[model samples]
Target: MDTTTAPDRDDWITTPLTAALLRGALELERTGHGLLPHRLPARARAQCTDPQLAMVESQPSGVRLVFRTRATAVELDTLPTKRNYTGAPPRPDGVYELLVDGRPAGRGSVTGGNTLTIDMETWASDYRPGEPGTVRFDGLPGRAKTVEIWLPHNETTELVALRTDAPVEAVAERGRVWLHHGSSISHGSEAAGPTSIWPALAASLGGVGLVNLGLGGSALLDPFTARAMRDTPADLISVKIGINLVNLDLMRLRAFGPAVHGFLDTIRDGHPATPLLVVSPILCPIHEDTPGPGAPDLEALSTGRVRFVATGDPAERAAGKLTLGVIREELARIVRERAADDPHLHHLDGRELYGPADHERLPLPDNLHPDAATHRLIGERFATAVFGEGGAFAEGGTSSPSAD
Candidate 1:
């Protein structure tokens, strides 16, 4: 376990963290310490200086290292950027999940990494650099097997080193690629671990490879994001829209419709015939009818529990203000109109993934993101809805849904 710096352990084989062994990241940047995975490409990242986008895009939601190894012991050195709120309870260390031949093998966490302290009220942030830490997994079967280490979906990590008792090589790509884009819910906000994130879970169940671009508080239908999706190679694609737009109060209905059309058009430019599914936001009591900009409940924060509330007026809908309800209706219409000519285009009401009944059974702890259990529920439902028989991504299933 202490072998990260133990020079006497000459049997330890160090492997370079190369792109061949990595999956789900659009680009990997050379950092001062090591390699930092980026969900968005350098071009997309340069278009925005928003700190929130910068942070979430680098969180590596569905990023993982896949390799074929006969090693019984593995160690990875990492420098993780952990977040802390000024007035809220500290978050736990992010978990690194290991899978052996596509099954859960082990889980570990690194300690002593960089910290970013954010003031929720002022939206100001401070950073403190720290030393790198090591995560180790031992006692694995010595036989050859495919191994995957899923990075923390909520933390930005820099891969510093990889060492194992035996040499490791990259694994060949497998399964269909499913590229998805959405907000923090799809970003694994409150999920227990990276593998447990809804998209990851759904991909696993659907037997597909996942490339997640679910940036937190940053999925505002940006052109760069749509372009990124456009250029990325994938057999299947889905965009979970509405939540971030409504919560951010980024645009009115007039802008939202055209923006969505433009986003899809850019994607279609690159993948004109790819199966593209447009999904609306799930049921969110706060923003279902009420418009947003969503605000943090300062009162709840005082008790160390983070909560959110919609701040915009429902009456503003007359002014073309967007709400979850309005967004869903618009998304359905757009998909219906587009699908008439594009047989591969389809729409799925997100409520099918998490609806009012499901909400009653398992309310969102923060009035926003789903809890771990709900994430699983959403994932299972998504797998069936999008990848099951007659679903959009199903084999020989090209017919679009009539309504969302």
Candidate 2:
């Protein structure tokens, strides 16, 4: 076959082919085309040769895995700097398989190792509830032909698998930047599926990329996190604040206002002209406007004794502190005032992403994190809000849904 001549599309069906025959002749091409809308995988330059399953994972870390023929070249593009997918039940020690040339070539693991080796920590073995761990792939045979990467079974993750007949090579491409910071909802909690999380969903919908800086229980306007956001690169940005602040009773209104201002200031230091959107929390009754720092009632957990009646104390909210509604209004006001001087700044009500209508239809089981269906709703809203024609999105064009 001539290497330069394009194959006739109809010729694909001209010959009798078997499963093994197809796998042997195909080359899994790895061109980093980046993601599309609807939380689908990025478009491919060409159809992969020995293509296999395309999976998404949040275990160990948020990554897309592609297995292919002869592991000679590797290039991972579109790394999220802000918030990478993290597991709910932290993974302790496990073996991940790497298949090469249609066979198992090597393996990677998280067993005995430093806690902070891969810029993460290990908590428990059976999927630690919220502990971050690193997954490293080392030791490869020079002549290996195939690879299979394993993910933590206890936790949900995202991935894309591939198999090729040619040497694997990495393709480089500059992707659009999306900087996002939110509570556990944004961190992929209790979500139906890893790839269905709101952030991932929205990223796919907008056809842009992101740096997820979502912390499980740590979205309390932390200066460290703000500093981290300030230090990162972003073409477009958003901050989903309030739920964690209210739930944790981390700050009062006096502290909350200034903290929010400071957080935006920090981010603006680097993303001066980028389109900045500030998003507040969705509906959550317990911490809507109450002082919580609410911990699960041990009594409820121990003997299943007390019911939901004793879960949270709502009196603190009456004393005046940060509530999701309060935060939403403040965020809108602050951005408006700031927008007078910085037109690029934007504000989005969290409810607009998933509000009362959604609750009336699909109530969040925990009254906090949204499910996969909600993620889809929110992702569609985001896509239409910014990327749609005449929408606020800076990139103006027909939105392309990322459908792999």
Candidate 3:
């Protein structure tokens, strides 16, 4: 494998099984140039076995992998919890394209979402040691320039293993750095494919390295989280906030406005005038102008049998105080006004990432979060708006003036 490519562009490669290893680990730590588990599987008590990550090839240029997590806790929601926000649960599967030098190699899949518990020692599947396991991508292009790999969402994956038929060395190179954070949407909820997920796609399109802080259901404007952002190194940064805020009803308008400013302010504390874009929540019918701490209208969902509290509308927000749009508009105004003094700051509407037309074609199966198609759409838009030629992701003007 002629793997001499620029580092940030397309250097590191992972096996399709990388997603499987991340299935449900609690903490991931880097190990021997790869990553290792910090916490055992939640259901390890049953000796969960047959947990091998398998990859299969498909026709017309595509790849599929099945991550079999045999454990008592291996439910349909193994990858992601199904809620109104994450649309519907996808079958436990992965679809991908085998690319050589960014060209198609083949397609693959594992085909089922089964939850079973087996003896760890009894699980005797061959631990394949080559890039090509049972199915191989023959006829790889002779002039292949680079290889790229994508992973599935909901799986708590780590870079545990790497194997290539041809030997390649790990090389480091400098490229644009991207730091991003958001909700489960940013976690790749129901996207068509791993690489197609918005953040991954945008990174691929923008030719930037990524530091994905997109924790699932954890984008709350916690002071420490903001402080974390303030200290992290980044070339381009974007924060997609608001959805989780509304969903959780975490703060009232009085506290919300200042929190937003403080979050940005903390970031500015470090990178005085970095090209920072604050992305507001995209269009969501519920919680637009509503104060949350939502109560589920059990009568509305179940046919009188089951009852639970669900999300609320935007108007009910903070004593009818703040809507997401209100926050978005207010944020832009704040940034623009502040930009006079902090010229490196910027703002972007999340809708520009994915809006109505995107919904019509790829409606959220659950009316809250986006599906895989919408993920691609949003990734495309984000790339075009911020990092494309003259996009916001560009280094642009920095306050450092004399510093390179």
Which candidate's TM-score is highest?
A: 1
**Candidate 1 worst ten-residue window by lDDT:** 1-10
Better of 1 and 2 by lDDT: 1
Residues 265-284, candidate 3, lDDT per residue (tens digit)? 88888877568877878876
- List runs of model 3 lying over 4 Å from the truth: 1-90, 94-99, 103-145, 293-310, 313-321, 357-361, 395-404
Provide the overall lDDT of each model, using Cα atoms, as 2-decimal numbers: 0.93, 0.51, 0.52
TM-score of each: 0.97, 0.61, 0.66
lDDT of model number 1: 0.93
Question: Superposing every Cα of model 3 onto the true structure, what RMSD results?
Answer: 11.6
TM-score, cand. 3: 0.66
What's the lDDT for residue 196 in model 2?
Answer: 52
Question: What RMSD, rounded to one decimal, does every model reach?
Answer: 2.4, 13.8, 11.6
Candidate 1: deviation at residue 208, Å? 0.4
